[model samples]
Target: VQDPKHAKKTARNQLHSGARLLVLGNNVMLYRHLLTLAQAKNHAIYIRDVVNVDKQDDGAAYRLFHSDVLEQMYQNELENNEMQSLFVYLFVLGDLFDSYLNRNIFHKERIIMAMRGYFFLNMWAEYIES
Candidate 1:
């Protein structure tokens, strides 16, 4: 179903039939798919762009920890023990810490971020070390 035309047709059909769409693809594909859906019904689509969040490292860790993404990553690590997905969680934490440190953030916030980084480091040490 990688065909652009087929993908657009499916997306349009799903939108017309009142079904929720979950599309997973690269940026170009996603952009085209979104365009197709928007064209299908003007001013009817509500798009929440969660795919582009790398620029916001400060709240990235907080949002990930509070959201289902962390749980999903944990489940993936439990099943696969690949350590790759787990690394992403830890990496985000590190990125958040770096972002906080580089900026003149509040001391209390920095302390909290440091604690979070430490906690995850200890929790995922074994997997990370492997």
Candidate 2:
């Protein structure tokens, strides 16, 4: 099947009479669905750990409780949990990081530029695919 000729011959056999253009199959949703599910599961575990930790160091506990990202996670509405929706949020996050790095990258050139490039490429790929 790796050979184009072999593939063509197989397809030609199937199409001989009135074979419908049937898509055999593809797990297009598998990765996207699993990634979204993992994110949700991780968030749940984080919340449980945060809640169950013995209240010893009030400062550390307070910091975890007051984390802005946690607040955003709670308040943000997840769109349909589709692949497109997941990446949209990721790129937006990456863009925010990129913007923050933009100002300081020139001063710290090498290190900052590397991080910036990562985010920029992430967003760029998402943009191109979408």
Candidate 3:
């Protein structure tokens, strides 16, 4: 779970399951711990970043980053044994938000601006239809 956005839920689940939970200063430390735990448990771990897209039809390259909790979990899984473990990056590009342009009323133009920037970099617009 490299995503800090959803770390709270993951942390809670780990604690509830009687797994030791520790929050290191940085992602590197967290990744190390996850590796150690996976080895000890004899269970393969996998990791991948999950992208949450607000719109399916609106092509966006990268969507909302996963929550921190999720990110850490993913990192741990990846650092362990990505090959054997079932690592999946879930993307909800279409269902995460209403309109891609106006995630919030205040920043109506922000998404559009981002798209323009993306186009400039890639030399083409990528639109994902929901």
Please give, for residues 52-114, the per-residue lDDT of candidate 2 as tens digits.
343343333223223243433444424443344323333443333343434644545545545
**The CA-based lDDT of model 2 is what?**
0.37
Estimate every model's Cα lDDT from 0 to 1. Answer: 0.39, 0.37, 0.31
Q: What is candidate 3's lDDT per residue for 17-48, written digit by digit as tens?
A: 32443222222223344334334333332222
Clashing pairs for model 1 are none
Alpha-carbon error at 49 in model 3, in Å? 18
lDDT of each residue in 1-130, candidate 1, tens digit only: 5542333234333323324322212111223333332233332233332233233243433333332434443443335434343335435454444434446767777777667766765765654455
**What clash count does candidate 3 reach?**
30
Query: Who is ahead in lDDT, 1 or 2?
Result: 1
Best by TM-score: 1
- Top lDDT prediction, candidate number: 1
Predicted structure 3: lDDT? 0.31
Q: Count the backbone clashes (under 3 Å) in each candidate.
A: 0, 0, 30
Reference-based TM-score, model 1 = 0.28
- Kindly give the stretch of ten consecutive residues in candidate 2 with the minimal lDDT sum: 22-31
Over 4 Å off in model 3, which ranges?
1-66, 80-88, 91-130
